[model samples]
Target: MKIRMRTIGLIGYLTLLMLPIYWMLNMSLRENNDIMSRLAFYPHHPTINNYVQIFTDPSWYMGYVNSFAYVGINTVISLLVALPAAYAFSRYRFLGDKHLFFWLLTNRMAPAAVFLLPIFQLYSELGLIDTYLAVALAHTLFNVPLAVWILEGFMSGVPREIDETAFIDGYSLPRFFLTVFLPLIRAGVGVTAFFIFMFSWVELLFARTLTITEAKPIAAVMTRTVSASGLDWGLLAAAGILTIVPGALVIYFVRNYIAKGFALGRV
Candidate 1:
């Protein structure tokens, strides 16, 4: 009886969690007219036209490409910059070190809107507007501080003896970091990269503000679904589903590391 009750509760919770996604999928498979005309749990006359249109339309599909390009760039830049900064924080003591670390976290604490105008002005002056580098750099203002904080926590957990032993064995700084130190905090790196990617990918304000047509992200493109006739409900639903896939895949791949990060890092 207890097992049966638990199973029922689990099913109920899952159903609630998945209801919106199922509804969106149902809408994606039906015509907009059918969607407006009736309320249905499932599509009676299902079609794949919405998905097909997105794939075939350059404007629709390039949004995904442009998003991935900048998101990739942001993640790489955040990690590269964060790793060394984190190492210094973890391994050394400097004048104003505590204040500096707190200051980095302060950047993450501030609202993105606070920096938007200044970032736009800087990028415009630099001719980085409407480019992948522009969006990527804009996102770093937040992601880098976060990456540094997380990586620092993970690095702090490592024994200082490891660094001493590596140096004693004549391992160069770069060689030791890549071959030994980084592997020791792989979970933190996975978690940091996942966060950086998701933040950059879903961030619309900076991406939209910085780009025109060439570097528009999918989130920004989704807003253009409205037309003279009305909203393209079916196409919008399809794009929404596709937009979710990349984040879902990232979570799936790094799921185990995320669990470890929660346990091991200062997440």
Candidate 2:
């Protein structure tokens, strides 16, 4: 009886989670006229025009390309910068180490809104506005701290004796970090990369404000659909559904690492 009840509860939970996504997909396949004039779970007139527009239109698809460019840059930069920082924190004691860690966390906790004006002025002066580098660098203010915190946890779990043994064997610091230490924490790196990518990918305020035409993110592009025609529900739904694809693909590739990384941080 208990097992049956648990099974039923699980099914109910899954349905609630999937229902909205299903509706979005359903609307993407539908015509705008049918959507507004009727109430139906399934589309009355299924069409592929919405998806076609996304692929064929330059303004539409370029947003996606621009988004991927910045997101990839941000993820790689965050991991590269954080790895060394995390290693330092985990392997040795430093002055005000705890305070430094807390300070990094506080940066992550602070509202992104607070940094907008300063970020704009700095980027404007440097002529970096509307460039991929601008958004990528701005996102680092948040992603680096998170990457360091998570990587530090995984790094702490590894025995310090390994570092000592590597030194005794005459292995250089860079060689040990790349060839030996990194593999031990590959799962944490995967998890951290996935998180950084998603944050840069979905975050709208920084991406929209920092870019004009040459580097506008897809999320910002979607907002432009609400013009004189009211709203292109079909096209809008299609774009939103497409936006979720990269994130889903990231999860699929890192499915194994995600569970392991989360588990290690517990204690």
Candidate 3:
């Protein structure tokens, strides 16, 4: 009886978790007329027209390109900057190091709204507004700290003896990190990169304010669909569904790494 009750509860939880996603999928598949007529458990006449429109239109697809371009760049830059910083924090003791680490994290804690004006002005001064670089650099401000935190945990799991042995073998610092240390932390790298990509991809405020045309991200473009006439519910639902793909792909690739990443530094 207990086992049967547990199974039922598990099924119920899964159903609850999946209901919203199923609803969105249903909405995306439904025709506009069917959707407006009344709320139904499922669509009477399903169509792929919304997805078709998005793929065939330049404005819709361009936003995806811009989003992927910046988020990809941001992930790479954040990892490059954070890997060494995390290693330093995990392996060595330095002046005001704890204070400095916390200070770096504080940047993540600060609201994006608070920094929006300054970031906009800074990008304007550099003549980088409405460009891919602007959004990528802005995302770095938050992503770097998170990468450092995640990578530091994994780095802490690595023994200092590995560094000593590498030094004795005449491996230089860069060679040691690239050839030896990096492989040991592959799981951490995957996890950190996944998070940075997910956050940067979905973030809209900075992307919206900093980019106008050339580099506007998908999240920002989704907002433009709502007009004074009425919400473009079908298109909006289609865009919302599409927005999950990148994040879902990232998680799929890193799913194996997540458990190991959490276990890192515990020993």
lDDT of 2: 0.89
**Error of model 2, residue 166, in angstroms:** 1.0
Q: Candidate 1, TM-score vs. the true structure?
A: 0.93
Model 1, range 78-144, lDDT digits (tens) per residue? Answer: 9999999999999999999999988988988888899889999998999999999999998998899
The residue pairs that clash in candidate 3, if any, are none
Residue-wise C-alpha lDDT for candidate 2, range 31-83, written one tens digit per residue: 78777888789877789889999999999999999999999999999999999
Using lDDT as the yardstick, the better of models 1 and 3 is: 1
TM-score of each: 0.93, 0.95, 0.94
Q: Which ten residues in a row have the lowest lDDT in candidate 3?
A: 258-267
Positional deviation of residue 193's Cα in model 3 after best superposition, in angstroms: 0.7
The list of candidate 1 runs beyond 4 A from truth reads: 1-7, 227-229, 260-264
Clashing pairs in 2: none
Ranking by lDDT: 1, 2, 3
Candidate 3 whole-model C-alpha lDDT, 0 to 1: 0.87
Q: Which TM-score value belongs to model 2? A: 0.95
Candidate 2 steric clashes: 0
Q: Best candidate, TM-score-wise?
A: 2
Q: Is candidate 2 or candidate 3 better by TM-score?
A: 2
